[model samples]
Target: MKYFLYWGCSLEASGVNYLRSLKPVCEALGMEFEEIPDWNCCGASVSYAGANDLAIKVLNARNLALAEKKANYDIIAPCSSCYIQMIKVNHEIQENESLRERVNSILAEDGLAYNGSIRVRHIQDVLFNDIGTEQIKRHVTKPLNGLKVAGYVGCQSVRPYGEYDSVHNPVVQDKLLEALDAKPVPFPKKIQCCGSGIFLPEMDLCLGLVRDILDDAVSHGAEIISTVCPMCAMNLEMYQDRINEKYGTDFDIPIVYLTQLMAVAFGMDLKRDAALHHNVIPPENILKAAIGN
Candidate 1:
């Protein structure tokens, strides 16, 4: 099925690896992604902190209005923060007619109005619900051969909206890993917060949280941590050395996107398609497990 991709800022910069692996995986799965034209930011958490609800809603409304103007297809957001923000606007506007009218009135400035014609879906939901595990299994050419991967769902995707999967106990990512022949380890803190953007101001606080996540994954015998959110991957992968230094521990775990693992299992080039070379923590163990070289 075709969907409009709402690529948040990170995909072009920090999360480029996710963008890289997403392309080949989608192609192999027969999923078409059309980027929304002239889409703006989804306002993410920064807007929430500023306490300007309408501003954030209007930001997402502009994108939704644009997508509706193009065609009536689901908007797929790969970023967890973007997905939550967009879906929040979609859900709230649908439930609150007055708010919808207000948002549309603001959109009138740009000759756009949203009748709530489409749905906002995360890439994780689309891969799990729309494209079932069995369907994904068909595309796997080189199975992971029991690679131990911890699926980090993070907070943005599950919190404030658990429509796709259980917020408390998420299984979508783990299920996808199992379909790829990778062993999804029993990780308790999968849903715990990764301290997201707070890592910048509160490095110590964020580092503590990241350290916990990494420790939990390692304790559970996970060789790699797979996630859907770029922020989560960034926090988990990019801070290993710092975490080790601060905590007086040795934590060396690879953080890879779920799409990357899918690309690898589908026999896509590790360096070219999966973009393993771009990851902060090299997933050499995963490469060895999947390719056996």
Candidate 2:
């Protein structure tokens, strides 16, 4: 019912729409989120790739340390990268006793230590597991009746830890969307990678990969791509022009947060509840049709 919300760096900075939409959805779901104090980076790609693996563990451990102080050790991250990294750290420290001591040793020097008691969770997981599909359906006064939404689970959030659900084929978002009466477009690229940290060094490769994802959804008759990760949304939605220029293709698919769709189905205002500020191809027409406007 309650969780220590970890607003990852990318989410707070670039995924502002997800933040705005998620707040209202959480309130509607009867959940409370207390932000963990002084939460630092989860060592996303920069630290994990550049610095020591121990550094990544300690970086996440510091945040877990903050969460450990709370009565409930549950920490929920809306960002997929953050969710994976946080849980990855917890899993690593718990499995490797030496690594745990090394992290605790470094933490003790800074008057911080984590017991690995923190339960790192993705928002989608909490929604499906904590709040059942039937409950979610009850909140849906305005169902996405005719709209076709492709569920994009990205790569990170469900993997390595497998806490929320299976990494092979994730259907939580699909099931949740179906519960709202939206036609779930199950595409092949739903669980595929969106380039991850390869966006910088290999922009072309990343663009090509993202293009495939967009095309897959559009080809599958998806009017809107409902996503759970900020990075995936950014790559799929933010790089549209580049994707078009690179592939010489015209794709205008809109990427929305799963929570945004839920909020709309729950009778929240179209403009206010699901502003979709980050989407390059605005979801106006698609969402309007879903809302029967």
Query: Which candidate achieves the best lDDT against the true structure?
Result: 1
| Backbone clash pairs in model 1 (N, Cα, C under 3 Å; residues 3+ apart or in different chains), count | 0
Per-residue lDDT of 1-293 in model 1, one digit per residue for the tens? 89898988999999999999998898778888888898888877766788687888899899998999999989889999999889988999889999999999999998999998889988888998989999999998889999989999989987778978999999988999999999999989999998986777788789999888888999999988999998999999888889889889999788999999998999889888999989877896656756575
**Model 2 worst lDDT run, 10 consecutive residues:** 270-279
lDDT of all predictions: 0.89, 0.84
Write model 2 residue lDDT over 18-69, tens digit each, in one string: 8878988888989988999888988776564688877787888989988897
Candidate 2 lDDT at 32 equals 89
Q: How accurate is candidate 1 locally (lDDT)?
A: 0.89
Off by over 4 Å in 1: 49-51
TM-score for candidate 2, please give it: 0.96
**Alpha-carbon deviation at 184 in model 1, angstroms:** 0.3
